[model samples]
Target chain A: MTPLRIVTQLLEIAAALIAAPAFLGWVNQCRAWLQNRRAPSVLQPYYGLRKLFGKDVILAENASALFRFAPYAVFGTMVAAAAIIPSMGTGLPLSTAADAIALVGLLATARVFVSLAAMDVGTAFGTLGARREMMVGFLAEPALLMVLFVAAMISHTTSLPLIAEGLTTRALALYPSLAFTAVAFTLVLLAENARIPVDNPATHLELTMIHEAMLLEYSGRHLAMMEWAAALKLFNYACIGFALFIPWGTGTEAGGPAALMLAAPLLALKLAVAGAGLAVVETLSAKLRVFRAPEFLATAFLLAVLGLLVYLLLGA
Target chain B: MAPLSFDLQLLNGCAALLLLLSFSMLSQRRIVNLVNLLALQGALLCAATLLVAVRTGQGHLYLSAVLTLALKVVGLPLLLHRLIRRLNVYWDAEPVINASGTMLIGLLIVVFAFGLAQPISALASTATRSTLGIAIAVILLAFLTMITRRKAMSQVVAFLSMENGLFFGAMSATYGMPMVVELGVALDVLVAMLVLGVFFFQIREQFDSLDLHHLESLKETE
Candidate 1:
């Protein structure tokens, strides 16, 4: 890779890391506004992260070493995922590892580590959360793979960058398969990110919460890392969505560094519309019962499979 | 195959939406939602027919599209809504198989339909021929919905969806049947619907509920 390209990639990664929490803050603000509540500042997540990093971590009486290390592991995996997903350009050097299937694997690894650490301290809420989290991951992972598989079949490649580039430059863009997979991927995204209608990100009910349940035992920097990683995970998912469904603004098939520069504002615009759409969806739907989550994921899985079938039948 | 033009893509999207609506109906236990899903499916079928008509320059297909719009989208859903209100069978307690299991089977059926149509789709020269597999999938899913559902009204909904799938399959495979055949089928559907409306009251009068499980008791007694 050229030095200029490498520098551009690093800048993209850093921009993502810095912008991740702000994206979360934006979604929250939009959700608050839609719900007719006083909105929190768009910098709320940053302030929360800073305050979290400065506090002291409390240890459980029977805390294991794994509990101490899981935050870093999850945070590192999220960073790896963000690096691999093309934010502004699809041809970053790390794009080689940006196979959408492999990205799912990375997310699963982070999930497993966090769950293992959740159960390490022998807390009831921690165990409950970990169990629920694994269940969601188990169902969601296949639906995600199926979504990627449909996109891969369309572009005839498994590499995310190549898929993005190919789809961006392809002729006759009204793909029925892409349309079906987009719907499926949206469902998977909501479930994976602990968004509404699956698990409420903002909820902390003892019997219902999934992500927050796992973090009940974490404190200080570890808590900050976990929370920050979650935000980064959300950002990565949005980037992945852009790369697949709306890869036009990406600099992959366009001019060199200048295209990358232009892509930033476009990315922000897509994210703004996407985040507000997410908020409206969250505002509209109620959470399903824990038992009903499988059916929800099943709908996603079936939709993804149907997309594949459409591609196979229609060759679109 | 015809070129992947905007109209063809729009037709394919309509088929995909139809398939989705079929699965939605299969999983739905609320009668209101099931009826709504059926109406949506009818609307999609109307849209697909209109698209096929416009793209192929077939004048007859336009009449069929209007028929689908009037009968399936407007007439049947309105009739079903009134049937539901009068019969008070708004909640389907459960199905023979659960919602998710029905969906899993429905997915397999779709795959099977595509496989079944792969060879046939190759020989067909229609502009919308690619959607034949989806039409078949829609047909089988409607049948599955019929078999698994407990309520008789939903069974009737599933039956209408089956006819819808047949209509869509015919249109995709051959640009629709002769106009005479289309008119006859539409008349048959209206008659069957009216007859079933009468049958529902007879059965409900006898059993005090529309659940078809009550019919099993009428079998030969030892």
Candidate 2:
């Protein structure tokens, strides 16, 4: 609404776009270190993105306009999601337009577009990947909604900014329901982001890759945009988790540039810890067979439901 | 005394966990894992009893908590593990209803239990009376477990878990039974386990397997 609010929203989006690749690179570096392998520079994803953008575009002979538009749409949706989530501050203007349900809708829209484009190429791998991706989305979405519902019930609102403010302003008390939902959220995150025990992001074994397979037909700028969007999606999920569970250090009031500056470092600290924890989990767990994915997601859904039940029964 | 709200929250958490463990037991296929889950449930029950004991200053509840710790958590799991090793039965045979369907039915049973407990919970004055629904659900799920299991070992474990549910239900509804009754039930459980242990070996020796499906032949026919 106001100029200052607009400026902060733009600042948040820019920070997400720039820092997203760095977050991915940080996870990879941590994973390599954990495995005792020579670590790549944390700037690797940025370099890869640059290299990808400069390459020539390749399109399938049967590709339609939707194929061309899907990358942009997915990338745009990720940006919008990042803008709505309060990464640096909870006082953003965009947070009013979208609640947690709208956030899930944005992610689902991106998923649908990507899957449609994957199937458009008419390649066996692309179709296979699209089916697998949709399967994961179907199961993960319900669990995610359940998690959000638990949080919403506690804060008495579905709005992300309001929820963050509610949690941050309250005196810290141990919430067993939140504790259960936190675990459920982590599982949903790993599954949605193509992480270990669901789909391995780093693998290219034609039969095993879900997200990578969908992007096999893409090249050059489109590939770069898609890849960047994936990183941004990860960043958005991390921010959402931070907003719900660990909302401290996020600016609750719309102060001047000084408050924004103070919040940035704290955001960085939370992201660092999240990335490291993700790396450790990914390293320690083996990639589950694709057939086992349903059971994995079922467990997540059950855990989320259990969290809701705990809140209902225990008032915690 | 600890704050009433704090004690209730702890007890309710334990109740939630007990229900979850029951659901897990219903779906679990591995016999060894089922025993471990049962132990975890027992530990949670012990904690809940201790919290209740502290809140109400009930000395017998403290003794009951210790008894539950010693018998259910430590004694039962150890006995089950030894029985498992001696019997060489690890994985349960395919259940009558698959795991997911069984879980769905278990969920329905929980809803029913909650509805059934509403009036009783209203009448009960204990701090943990609200958990009566969960306790009943645990018991019913254990019964479901007993019905669906094809192996004798799993059935025994389910039976023990059902007893756990009854113990929990009694605690929530009436702050547990009299000490003499609790002791009597505990001894009854121990004796039943020893008897079942002997039965498992005899059945396995006669049938060369632990599957209870073979017992169907014992029915008198025209």
Candidate 3:
């Protein structure tokens, strides 16, 4: 691997690792502001993580080895996801493995591990949460793939970095297909990240909770790892969205690692804007009933497929 | 290439927005929101027509765009809102099919429209010919909305949306029809809306409800 490529890859992963929690905190702070509550510090997640990490582990009575292993597996997979997304540069050594299908597979792997761990505890809420999470996963995955397919179709390759690079270098033009896919991708992002109108990330009420219900059995560092992984997943998804839609700042390969360095502030700016938009969406809409989650995701899927059709029809 | 003397990308963006507005109207249950979506559709149609007019140097299309803004966007929606107020049909009852099923059918109709428009799009020479499939899809989806909806006001909105799709189809395929024909069609649509508005009152008076289901009882028994 070229030294610059390797450095850019590591830089991207490390930045995502550090910024993920901050991104979550930003969204939470924005939500609090929009709801007219006193806003928390944007560093609130880091404070919570520090507190959680310093505590001792406490596990369920019948916790299996799998329960102990899932948190690390999930965290590792999200980091791996972050590594491949080309947020800082389009010429990473890991770009070979950054195929859109492979990226989807990595995400699915993390979801599987988390769901399996949730069911391992055997609590009623745990199993219920696992079921709901799986339902969302299956429904959202196809839409996610369809979103990527439209991008891939345009770039004539399934590789994420290549798509971003292709779009960056091409002359400016509007792809109606991209417009349609963007709406679909936003819907998928909201659902996959347990955001509003699908599942409320803030809800802890037993009957209504989906993501939180799964983590009720974990405590201490394990819980911290799981929460960190959740944040990283959101960060990674946001980066993917950036890579697909607003890929301008990442720069073409001829610009080199200097361009990668230049991308950092732009990435931060995008995260800030996207996080605020997410908060606005969550504030404006109520969570759908659990039964309606399928319909919500179904609409996302249809919109993504509509993007593909638009691409085909317009040949754009 | 001097950028073709017009923004083709802007035209495509407008076409995409028109399709999205169509989908929003299809899924909307509130009569008021459906009327608003129809007006939004008209605005996008006007924008697309203006783009084509600029590209082709056809002065008639500009007149058509202004007509669209005045009639479809302003007049029809205002008329529909008054009908909704007078008829007092605010919320549509449960559609004949659920939202998810309706979306699935709409998706199929879109695919079929693309397939059907393929040969025609190839033969057409206009800058917006590629949007022909979307125009046809809009028409069919509007038709689908009419079939699945239960309220008279919603059906009227869907009918106007269908007219929008037809107008879009004509624009994409031929840069627009002859001005006389376009004006004649606009008058026809305005007259049709008025007649439909009167029928809304007659139906409400006869059946005491705006739900088309009320008229079903009057169907000749087998």
Candidate 4:
């Protein structure tokens, strides 16, 4: 509750809210460029969110309270997650309240709420989506935890900012464990955000969509919040990877106007590299079958565990 | 630490009761009685956590205690009850391992856990670290209960009871994990109970019984 950290947290939340839609739009733009197609405007996601937010929500007569409240819960959880992660600097106030492991739990809480709301509708697609979502969650959680555990072990602290600061400022010696973990974390990030090779976020095809399938019934502001939440989630996961693997250029805890100014461009450059990297991966890889997702996540988990073992045994 | 103060005695008694309930659960066959035993365990956990909170003045322990009360005591058992009612599986199903055999296994686990926890207990700075071995024993015994139980519902209860051991271990070793972690773990347990509740119905629907040996048939076919 230090005033300076509180101010940093508020600024970070505001930045995530403003930047998330643009990040999504940037990824779309990069995908289009890679595919040699005309690209949408950089602000297209933001515009879409705005239009949806201004419209009236239409709910099914059978919708329950869980269904109605899911979007808010989802959005609130993502907002909370963003506040805790150090997007611009390593001194977020909310960082004290939770660590990276709890961050994964927050995401899991949001996933559970959304999955329940999806199933509550009682449609065949909704149930299918809920089942698939839970399956993904069950497999993804351990991998995610192990990834965070690697970073935590390296820093000897679970605080996200401390992990970032420790890795960035530490000696430049190559840690093979972190190298494997970084790759594993990248795979998890892609799978979790519903990118290619695990899920096709762009397609609304019934048998193929995982994230989109759950959103079949949402419209208007509810849909907007969910989409914004989706974007926020993708942004958050990317920032988490950035904080862990590429911690350089994140401003220090002692806040100053110069640090803030430098952070803006550094963030933009980081986002550009990440968006393009995601597009390249998506373009190169094909989506795996639904049943095969367990194997994919299992590999991530094994890699993470292997990384932990290496770090523990060899102290690298 | 304080030459046997009231709070210390109450905390110790609560910890002892929690371990006793965990052992009873290891031997309990009837699902209904198992659920009741789990509730008792939760109550004892709440009392122990609250005593620690009051004694050490860590505000987060109070939240953890309330969470143990709500999720473990009230929430999960209720969910299990409803699942049992819906699945029509209140009666005792044959366990993969007999009760006496399971209790013997549990006794061995207790001894092993004490040996395993010796170094950790020595390192732990908390006054409750003496119970660390018990917490480990409870966790191992719960794991054994899950493995030996043929019924799916009983196994889920065992899984949840294992979480109780983990929470207690954290409390004894580190005064509880960070507040966010405790909350997240609580929410995770609640969500898991709900998901398992749904799974219970699905299992019964498919197999016509809550026996998980039916699920071993679900192994991947080439």
Better of 2 and 4 by lDDT: 2
lDDT by residue for model 2 over A14-61, one digit each (tens)?
A: 999999999999999999999999999999999999999999999999
Give per-residue CA lDDT, model 3, range A1-316, as digits (tens).
7788778888888999999999999999999999999999999999999999999999888999999999999999999999989898887888796598999999999999999999998999999999999999999999999999999998899999999998898877777788778888999999889898988888777597889989999889999999999999999999999999999999556888678778999999999999999999999999899999999899889889988988887766
Name the candidate that leads on TM-score.
1
Measured by DockQ, the strongest candidate is 1
| Candidate 3: Cα lDDT at B88 | 82
Stretches of candidate 1 off by over 4 Å are B1-3, B219-222
Estimate, for each residue in B58-80, the C-alpha lDDT of model 4 and write its tens digit.
Answer: 99889888888888889888877
Assess each model's interface with DockQ, reporting 2 decimals per model: 0.70, 0.36, 0.60, 0.01
Question: Candidate 3's residue-wise lDDT over B26-85, tens digit each?
Answer: 899998999999999999899888888888899999999999999999998998888788
**Mind giving the per-residue lDDT tens digits that candidate 1 earns over A160-267?**
888888888888546777888898899999999999898989877658889999999999999999999999999999998999999888886347878888889999
lDDT of 1 by residue, B1-222 (tens): 434778777787788778888888888889999989988898998988888898888999999999999999899899999999999888987899877788888888998998899899889998778889999999999999999988899899999999999999999899999999999999999999999999999999988999888898756353
DockQ of 4: 0.01
lDDT of 4 by residue, A63-179 (tens): 999999999999999999999888888878778889888999899999999899998888888888888889988888888898899889988999999998888777665555577
lDDT of each: 0.89, 0.90, 0.90, 0.83
Model 4 stretches astray by more than 4 angstroms: A1-3, B1-222
TM-score of each model, paired residue for residue: 0.96, 0.95, 0.96, 0.59
Model 3 CA lDDT for position A181: 86
